[model samples]
Target: MNIGFDGKRAANNLTGLGNYSRSLIAQLAGFFPQNRYFVYTPKIKNHPQINRFLSIPNILTELPNVPGLFWRTSGIKKQLLKDNIDLFHGLSHEIPLGIHKSGIPSVVTIHDLIFLKFPQYFGRIDRFIYNLKFRYACKNSNRIVAISEQTKNDIIEHFNIDPEKIEVIYQSCDDSFKIASTDQLKESVRLKYQLPEKYILNVGTIETRKNLLTLVKALKQINEDHVLVVVGRKTKYADLVNQEIDKLNLRPRIIFLQDIPFNELPSIYQMAAVFVYPSVYEGFGIPVIEALYAHVPVVAATGSCLEEAGGKYSSYVSPFDHNGFAKAINHILDHPKVQKEMIEKGKDYVQRFNTEIISKEMMGLYTDVLKLHRSQHSNDAQLSTRPQRSRRSQRTSKN
Candidate 1:
């Protein structure tokens, strides 16, 4: 089977959607080498992580023959036909316009509807464009792959799509997170980052939706000596969090890190005393899974899909409850047995989202969709070629 993917995020984005795109494509190419895979992007940039996928024998990357907005919207259909693609998958929440008219079965992965859910967080123009593109993709695509059940429900409620058409497939973290790092490697990472001896790690962009200020407030209540290490690009929301930190006099206790190399993140995850994700909402929390895969105890917020990502062993508390988060952190720190149990359970639970398992499920779905498409095409051809009665014969039969 020939498979094509919208590789914009895979080539450009460094986190979240990019990770999902690169991992999914790599796993499919590595595990099922017989199928030919093509990645179509508007342009290619110098991305080291994305570049590695090009080494796979079955995978090929293509740029738009005709550049600009035309390629992004309607010109892609011509390329898909030129390449003889059997199916096209949109790694992000959009597919090219007129793909359905071109008769190419398409699947789209809707990461989240956050722009729609929280209009205040986005600009009016951005929200309008997102709504238009997302609604069109959801309505026209042959299948939808929701990263979590929460996202799937949101799609149904907002777009009125059929539940059967959406599949809840979880995302996995990088393999580096799952592998146990040696003591030397951990020590090197610690020295490189100047990490505190004991720290609570939070990984994500600093935005209003992440609810980082609540975590900062909770830090004042905890009696432990652990620092809070935040690793991500800061937005305007960081200024608000910083003001709270200043008011509470917790500046010395919080560490903010940005632009950490991708290779060193696993070691940093392993060295943390505990991993905390206080986000108020998420499509699927990859950091929680990363913490679990790193053999660290996870404490995530309760109102969204964090529980699903963290699994049964991890603790969940309200995003607004500072006291609850502080208590959960102390409990994990104070009890060695509790930490051991969480690590064991989390390691086992994360296997469900492993690369091998997810790739196989995706391959099965693609095969089924392609088969159905071929069968429909054959039936349409037969009908078009069937004999028709003459006008006189039709009149006699009518009499």
Candidate 2:
């Protein structure tokens, strides 16, 4: 089977979507090398993640014939047909327009409906365009993959897609987070970042929806002397967060670590006493999983798919409840027994998202989609070939 993937994220993005695309593609090749996989990206970024993706066996990367805004949206359909793509998978929220018209079965992974769910954070024009493409893909694709049950529910409610048409597949972080950092590695990373000796960690974009201010407020409530370490790129939201931090007189207790190399992330995770994620909403909270794999006790926000990612042992609190978050973090920090339980149980829970299991599930979905397409085609052929009674015979019989 020749499988084609929309690889724009895999080739360019270094964050959430990029990691998902690269990890899934690499795992599929590892498990199912008998099939050929082609990655199509409009532009490629020279990054280590892309290099790792390119290194995978039984995979080929292609670029668009000519550059245009709609290359991935509509122009790629003709190229997919030319490649004899048996199936196409959109790694992000959409697939090429009219792909079904080219006689190619397709699957699209809708990671979230965040723009629709939280419209205030997005521009009107951007929201309109996103809604158009997402609705189309949900209706046209042979199957839809949602990263979590929450996201799957969102798709059905927002797009009115059949519940059975959407499949909820869990996503995992990079396997690197699972490895324990050596004493030497930990020392190097700590010194390099000038990280706090003891801190509560939060990793994600410092954006409004991420709710970093709440975490800072929680920090002020904590009785312990530990500081807070934030690791992510800052958007304009950082300015508001900074203002709040200053107003609360918590600047001395906060450390913002920027542009830290990806290779050192696991060590940073290992050094933290506890991980706190206070995002108000998420399709799936991946940083929570990374913390779990790092064997750190987690206290994350409620009202989203985080529980699914963090599992039963990780503590949960309302995103707005700074006091509640503080209590949860302090509990993990103060109680060694509780921390042990969370660490051990979290390790067991996150195994459900390991690469081998995800690879098998992904391939199973592809096979099921092709089977459904072939079954429908067979029925259509039967209808087209079925003999019909002549008009004269019908009239004579009626008389």
Candidate 3:
């Protein structure tokens, strides 16, 4: 079987869906050596890493340089038909309409429906197009892969998709995130980023959905010597977030490291006094899993999918309750015994979400879909070969 993945967005983005695409595909290639893969990417000058994936006998097909219309490149269908791809997977929500028109079996991974859930968060044109693309993907795909049970429920409730067609495959943390030699790695990362020795860590895009304002407010109320270290790429809300920090007069205690390499993240997680992720909405919070894998005591948001990822191990807090969040942080900081227990529980909790298990489950879904499709085609072919006799004669013969 030949598999095709959308590697265009993945080659560029360092966050969220991109990381998920890269990691999941890499693990699939490693685990399923028998299947062939073709990764379709956009035409770019200096994408060198695409060549590295060739070690798995994969081919890279580049899209043309069409402005605002590159995603609809019908050339991908020509390539897929030429390459005889048995299955094509959209790692993101965007699926080329040509693929659906060509009657190909395509599966799309719907990370989340945040834009649909909160239309006010997005602008007019974006919200309009997002709903359009989301509805098309939900209605046309052969199967939908939801990263969490929460996301699957959202799909069923929001879009009227058949539950049988959706599979819940939880996302896993990066394989490199594990219990590290804290003294050495921590000091190295801390010095490199000029990080405080005793600090609470928060790693996510600083957006309204992340509930950064509540965290900033909570920081002002906490009476510890600990600083709040935020690590993520700068987004549109960076200025607004800074204003919120200034308003709280907690600028000195808030450290924002906007530019950091992915390799340094695990060590940073290890160095944290405790990791807090108070996101208001998520498909599956990957950072919570990362913190757990790093054996860091985590305080995650209560109602979101992070609860599923954190299980009974993490301290839960509301996204809007600044006082409650501060109290939880103080409780963890004060009790060394409770912190140690949480750390141990975190390690045990993350073991159930290993990449190997996730990869295997995904492969099983692929195999099952392939078999079902194959059997249907076989039955159709047999029916086509049979002679068409008169119904009355057939009924008489049966009598």
Candidate 4:
């Protein structure tokens, strides 16, 4: 089978969506090399990661023959047919407007409906556009892949889509996060970044919904010397968090890092005393999984799908409960036995999200969708060709 994927994020983004797109495509290609994979993008970026991926024998990347603002919407329609794609998966939340008419089954992955769930974080125009595109994709795609059950439920409630149409497929982290780094590598990374000897780690975009201030508040409650290491791009909300840090006199204890190279992130996770994700919500927290795979104990907030990522072994607390977070952090820090158990259990649990497992499940979804589509297509063709007779002819035959 020839599989096509929407490769916008895989080409451009360096964050969560990019990581998911790159990882999923690589896994699928690696596990099922018998299937040819085509990654379609409106444009391309020169990144070593993308170059390495394209070097695969069975994987090819394509761009529009004619460039335009609306190329991704419909321009790729002709190319998809020219390439004879059996199926297309939109790695992000959208597919071309009328892919079904092209006779190719399509699936779209909806990461989250955060814009709808928390409208305050989005502008009116952005929200309107997101609602329009997301609803259209959910309605038109042959199937939907939600990164988490929380996202799946949100899609159903907001888009009024059939539950059966949506599949909850957890995303695996970049392969780098899962590999074990030696102590020398960890020490090198520590020296390069001037990291604190003992620090609690948090990794995600510092945004309002992520609730970074909660981490700051939680840190103020702990009497230990362990600083907080926040490694993500900061938004305007960072200013408010900085104010909170100053108000609490915890600025000296906070470390904000951005633009860390991808190769070094695993060591950062490994060197931390504990990993904390205080986000109020997520589609599925990849950082939590990254930490788990790194053999670090995780403490993330409640009120969303984080528990699913952290698994039952990790600790959780209310996003607003500074005391709860502080106590949880201290418990793990002071108790080597508890840390060992959580780390061991988390490592075991994360195996469910290993590359081979997720890739196989995705291929299974693709095969099932293809078989069903062909079966239905065959039925439709038979109905269209069935002989028709007038009422008089039918009466004469009956007589």
TM per model? 0.97, 0.97, 0.92, 0.98
Cα error, residue 176 of model 1, in Å, equals: 1.4
| Alpha carbon lDDT at 10, candidate 3 | 59
- Candidate 2 structure, TM-score to reference: 0.97
Summing lDDT over every window of 10 consecutive residues in candidate 4, give the lowest-scoring window: 45-54
Query: Could you tell me which residue pairs clash in candidate 1?
Result: none
lDDT of 1 by residue, 1-399 (tens): 889999888878888888889889988998999999999988776867777866678989989888877787679888999999999999889988989889899999998999978889999999999999999999988899999999999999999999999988889888878898999988998988789789999999999999999899999987558999999999999999999999999999999999888888998899888899999889999999899889889999998889899988999999999999999998998898998999899889988889898899899889878888889999999999999899999999999
Candidate 2 C-alpha lDDT tens digits along 236-292:
999999999999998888899877778899999999989989998999988998998
Candidate numbers sorted by TM-score from highest down:
4, 1, 2, 3
Between prediction 1 and prediction 2, the one with superior lDDT is 2
Candidate 1 lDDT at 157 equals 95
Candidate 4 wrongly placed segments (more than 4 Å): none
Question: What is candidate 3's lDDT per residue for 1-399, written digit by digit as tens?
Answer: 888887776566667876787778878878887887777776433444433443445444445433355444455677677778888888888677767667467888998988888777889999889888877887887789999999999999999999999999999876878647557776888898898879999999888788887888888877559999998777777788888887878888988887676678888888889899988988899999999998889997887688899989789998899898999988999999999999998888888788889999988888787787778878999999999999999999999
Error of 3 at 233 (Å): 2.5
Worst 10 residues of 2 by lDDT: 216-225
| Model 3 TM-score, all chains together | 0.92
C-alpha RMSD (angstroms) for model 1: 1.3
Question: Number of backbone collisions per candidate, in order?
Answer: 0, 0, 0, 0
Residue 253 of model 1 has an lDDT of: 94
Q: Sort by lDDT, best first.
A: 4, 2, 1, 3
Q: Tens digit of lDDT per residue, candidate 4, span 60-159?
A: 8888888889888888888889999999999889999889888999999999999999998999999999998899899999999998999999999999
> What Cα-based lDDT does every candidate model obtain?
0.90, 0.91, 0.81, 0.91
